[model samples]
Target: MTNDKKRWLILILLAFISALLLAITSTAISIYLYGNKTYTAKAEAAIVLGAAVWGEEPSPVFRERINHAINLYQNQQINKIIFTGGVGEPNEAAEAIIGKNYALARQVKLNDILTETESRTTYQNLKNARSVADNSKLNKFLIVSDPLHMKRAVLMARNLDMDAYPSPTPTTRYSSLRSQIEFLIRETFFYFVYLVFQI
Candidate 1:
């Protein structure tokens, strides 16, 4: 073959290999992230990860997660609900407070609701909630959130040695799709870096 033709062929082969590797990596990550299941049986508590609260109310995404946790309580799947989120802004109201109020409005008992209102991110949410649960001598619990976030939550919980299962709530269809794609891409890059450092 001509030298130029051989170089072009080599470039095409490299491109094909790169595409295949990307596809495989994406598929594996998707399966890993999407395979977590919601809690189905009784547990010590249901921990709802906080999202933004709009004017002392739960955002739509936050509301969905709170409602799902409430449903678990109503069904006796868990005895307590722990809402975790920090204050969004000065006087903006804590995400946990908003989630707690949302459940209270739905008739969840006051004492059964707990709040970890100092977590500004998912890792912190799980960390703070787990600390409270540990103090209370609770063992198993459910982590409630958007589906795309469940796997990360579960992994974090396991890393902290908590017996946690995911219980994702319904998210807005278009938003869920968009969020999933964005998270998948971002996490793929993050995980690649993580792997590089063996983290």
Candidate 2:
């Protein structure tokens, strides 16, 4: 290869290595940040971020999060459960309704649960939940979601000045790998933008 071509190849290889290293580092940080059990101490509430619902029923992903939250409630790790999510597409049930009904079916008392049916994204979920928490006089909370999704949720909660800990629900092995990779990339880009513009 020509010297210029060889140099370009080396630069490309370095860039690829750097990207790979960054991905690995981010994944490790996510696991570390999200894998801990944060509900060991009693909290005022546990918030289960919403996933998609199918025809007014909780999807498997949403069920997993609700199950985790229910476990926490049953164990007295949290005093209340907050289900957050709104209907985004027609024909799909609101996530909060699906979550509330699922817990109710499991015999969780209706009075013990609060629903925020206005948030359509993780950021909004935290935003709406924070409002409820503030009004309820809850200063600490455990935020529950899929392990891979918890990092962003935790960061968003902290950015909103909420004292939040991550309590990730069980996810199918490899189910989140692709989406996690995409999220990591997108988050990195956005992080840089936020740093630059403080947005």
Backbone atom clashes (below 3 Å) for every candidate: 0, 0
In TM-score terms, candidate 2 sits at 0.77
On residues 1-199, what C-alpha lDDT tens digit does candidate 1 reach at each position? 9999999999999999999798758755773456455568789899999888899788888888888898899989999999999998898989999988888999999989888999997879999999888877789989888776676677778888999988877553216557667766665655454445533
Q: Relative to the unseen true structure, what is the C-alpha lDDT of residue 174 in candidate 2, on a scale of 0 to 100?
A: 22
TM-score (C-alpha) between model 1 and the true structure: 0.80
Reference-based TM-score of each model: 0.80, 0.77
Candidate 1, residue 101: the lDDT equals 87
In model 2, where do residues sit more than 4 Å from their true spots? Answer: 1-33, 36-39, 171-199
lDDT of 1 at 159: 82
Every candidate's lDDT: 0.81, 0.81
